[model samples]
Target: MSTGDGVDEVAEFAALLTELKERTDRSYGSLARRLGMNTSTLHRYCAGEAVPQDFAPVERLAEFSGATPEERLELHRRWLRAVAVRQAARPRTATTTEPEAAVAEAVLPEAAVARTAEPEAPPAEAGRADAAEAAGADSGGEVGSGGGPARRWYRRRRTALLAAVTCALLATLGTLSALPADRSPSASSPWPSSSADTSGSAPARTTAPAAPRPSPTASPNRSSSPSPTPGGDSPTPRTPEPSTSGGTAPGDATVPLTWTADSQAWALGCGHDYVVAQPPARVPPPPAAQDAGPWAAAQGAVHGRETVVEITVQGRSTTAVVLTALRVRVTGRTDPAPGNVYAMDQGCGGSISPRHFAVDLDRDRPIARPVAGNDTGTPIPAVRMPYRVSSTDPEVLLVTARTQGCDCSWYLELDWSSEGRTGTVRVDDHGRPFRTRSIAGLPRYMYDTSARRWTPYQ
Candidate 1:
């Protein structure tokens, strides 16, 4: 069947599968080994020459290849369409037994009347009739005399019965053809719905149970807590957590800790600064704190001086995940981006007390050190690692990575343990490393809100 795009459903599904496989950068043999399937079988599925009886294998392959949630849902829909097409193309056979029985029932009464009319016959005639019956049985024909009025009547009746049966079969076929083609799965279908758990290891079943609905009262992954201001006794502004859902399950090989990183979170003081390749005249006015990421991208900007990233981590299945440590891996170091310095704001004076860590990117081997908030009057104590996070209780970490000597491209590695399993999850700006360029000697500028124009920083 077509998938509304003129391409066959099976071919579309195969194309998506092949794309995911290629994105992983893993060889077919290695991926097959991890999936516990033959290499040739996977090749056939990706080649559009075959489809799997179960979707579990496909799901596992998708997860291993790092498909997003939306992609996975679309893949499931395509699989359903392909399965429907295959089922419809199968040949169907009709049985003739029921129609033949109906014909027999209709002819029984007439045959009895004919027999009554024909009373006792001569011995020779009876013997001849018996021989005719034997010959008819051997040839699988009607049970009647060889050539007489009765035999002719029987032939006419048989012809009418055959004609009636043929008409009925035609009518049935027409009715079937008039009905709409339904691609949806039937009540008895073995495949699961799109909402089924996508943990990459769900077993195939005849019927999928309803997925558990998320609770209305469930707390968000990022929650705000009160922290002290830089100087005054008043409470500080609540640092908003990154908006994200619960963690995803990474199969049985590692801990089921789900996390997300937001690099655009409030960077207090000069933390929101960025170095754009454009000049002051070409740059747009500074945007709100939340719009910093996109604004910087539009101006072709890179993080300046330091980049403060907010990471929210949660556990799946109500199990607690212990965050052991945060490690920094610097991929490259070079001279800072050559451009004008732009500050997101004149100044953001607030102390952040969320599990804060600091990384000096200029060091050969940078380490994440737990650092206190930037409060001068009273230093907020630093929260240490090994924090427990569950579905009901999630934790947020604010990592401030700074560089003074070089422009650094780096990413974070989070080591976690839960339920006797331990593994590491890499955190970066999507698939690329987070970049922070040193702004040691550049002039800082900010948009003057009162004047509605860009001005040099005081």
Candidate 2:
């Protein structure tokens, strides 16, 4: 593959895998027979001549080698990187034309064209011909034309434009490279988690027993050269510690909220992208709002950004964990309050379970609430909901609800202000309610508990 660096990342991983296999002292024939595949296929994969699209075999090999949890994680990360390199090397198009050819055909002068018209031309002459054609095109004159001074001027301008565009394209690519690449929750690991996630959280660290040191006889099949341990330099993602929660008054107690998810979820914002995972590490709570003038002070709500975890449950029991972060805020509260807000969505049966918690810093306790719809006499469970505390306005917490098993759902306006001062109101959902949006400019509507009718939302 013609990666500019000319490094065969796939081969590197293959070598690493080879080292691991040798440590197990299992011959290719024995391994292949166990995996029920051709021996050459395994060799090809180990030799870096080919990569396995499905990772089952690789995972199995890791298991056979008795790789430790960290080592296994490293192996997976390396495999992913190798796959990425291989895919990137694949040609995107069946055919491509040289840019010079197009320029030459479009702008070459007749004399120059005739001289370079041979079926084949030397590299040096071809280069000169391309330059001459580019010069001709810059003049803004027909291929056969002559605008001596004008052509020179145009050529200079054209060259400048090309240089500027090249710079711009390079800059854009660099920025894109800085962005976190998206990977499905199932692809990286089975679980999802976040510390303060808004979208899917990043992969969490896994622990496994370390493999025993191979015997001297087992070392014979391995190459003499040392193999680099994968992800050795990378920081291992740590499980977030559980946050503490419990108080009622501003300084009486501070409670930390507990967040859980049956599967992985995503949280994207604040320049950090992640997937939710479990046993999350604690993060700093949101800082209190700055004291500006009275108007500025009342302008936006103070928000907390922290890492959180997501747990994958099987019939009420957690099976795996992932980690991510989230941004939470409480409206109409800004005086360095000892609490933070957290929200979670979990898969419950055929629908979704929505929950949000407020951690009281002073008392160290959490206040949990399940946000549901009361459309029918009985509450209809929601499948998913999008919500957020207002930034500029300190009194609005916007949320929209949607049901999973059925088509029943609506919008809710929550007053996530101070304790003893918060409230919730059901409003017309504008039909499609799964989407999260602000109700600030929406048509005035509110649920009339007594009349049970939509009325102006004063």
Candidate 3:
């Protein structure tokens, strides 16, 4: 399999498929026969020329090759990534041409409109129109011998009407343009006034006082007190600043950073261990690591003793934002969740050298502590904040929060500053606090790869 920098998912998927087929010592024709597909079709899939719409064939092939559970899981992940890329790359058919065509017809001259409308004409009628035009041109601008005078008269009338329409349209546009920028056109005007507010409310001022500077030590949950203006009057209501090309305005309530949190991140080189309330028999077999989030939810599972959340953060604009700190706010604490613990993978070993932080949820004041690589034993220097990120440069932080004393419900607050504005962004599991329950002394189970069943962990 392709590894390390600049890996193409589609190519990696195809490489794995080719590797599996080669391990089985199977030829394209032989595998195709078994897969109920043509040799060429199978070859295309293995060569990365095509991705299968359904995963059934790929799964069957893996089983036929006697792939280990981990290998199968990796294969599935690669396939999913490849399929997503393919779907996103597919071209969307244009379905919005009619509105543009109407606009073109509204502004074009009559002759230009007629020419533009020709493509919509019936084939036979369009052919005849072209022939008539050719004949008129060849005959020195005459329609025919007897009808030349009548045609000339009709053409003159048509030209005069077109000129009058053009002049009237231009005058209307000029009148609209001459109107004051702040004034809305009357209701009787031809075009709807975009700036007019139909609601019978007080007109909003065009400008407002600048917002007060945010306190650096302000609590994330505490609302800031409004600052008084110099005239001792209540500060004018702040207007929302227009979004800048870099991102949302700094004073806006919305954070300028965009982030994705993966709650199923690998912990200490092992797959996620979820503490589900269901019994081993009632709960389904553990899914692959990538699908763990949904599976854990369906089983009503919380993270085991340690929950490693991988968060990828980047600024929405080109402006560099420095991530100052990550703070943990505990919402609740209780006894360990009562249930069985399900481990998604058996004993597995790997190295994770990403920039990571650790949180001790049992502590009175839990703070994210920068940590070195996990499982490798070799200690690397830990780089602590502040880290800079931009639209082009994203940073990934792996946060592992462990609780052995009590179950904890918590979320993270990321403090960031850019340009002279600082703000705090709350990060949680889709608006809900992340829950991690102490799995100590709980019944533990692991999927036995050989038997393909959940078994009690010794």
By TM-score, the best candidate is 3
Q: Please give, for residues 1-458, the per-residue lDDT of candidate 3 as tens digits.
A: 22321137788888888877765444688678877888998999999889898878887676555454445556766776676556435553566353333333334334244644423444665566567767888877845444444444445655665566566656645543442221122344222234545477553322232543545763322222222122232345434332221122353333446666767776655567788877777888777766666676677778888888877787665556778888999999998747888887677756646557889999999999987653366554464676667765567778889998898998888888665456776677655687888888988999887887789987
Tell me the TM-score of model 3: 0.45
Compared with the true structure, all predictions reach lDDT values of 0.64, 0.35, 0.64
Q: Where does candidate 3 stray beyond 4 Å?
A: 1-254, 374-379
* Worst lDDT 10-window in candidate 2: 313-322
At residue 59, what lDDT does model 3 achieve? 75
Q: How well does candidate 1 score on lDDT at residue 457?
A: 83
Tens-place lDDT digits, model 2, residues 363-427: 22222233444332544333122221111111111121211121121222222212112222212
The C-alpha TM-scores of every prediction are: 0.45, 0.22, 0.45
lDDT of 2 at 403: 15
Residue clash pairs of candidate 1? 247-258
> Cα miss at 296, model 1 (Å)?
1.5
TM-score ranking, best first: 3, 1, 2
Point to the candidate with the largest lDDT: 3
Candidate 3, run of 10 with poorest lDDT: 221-230
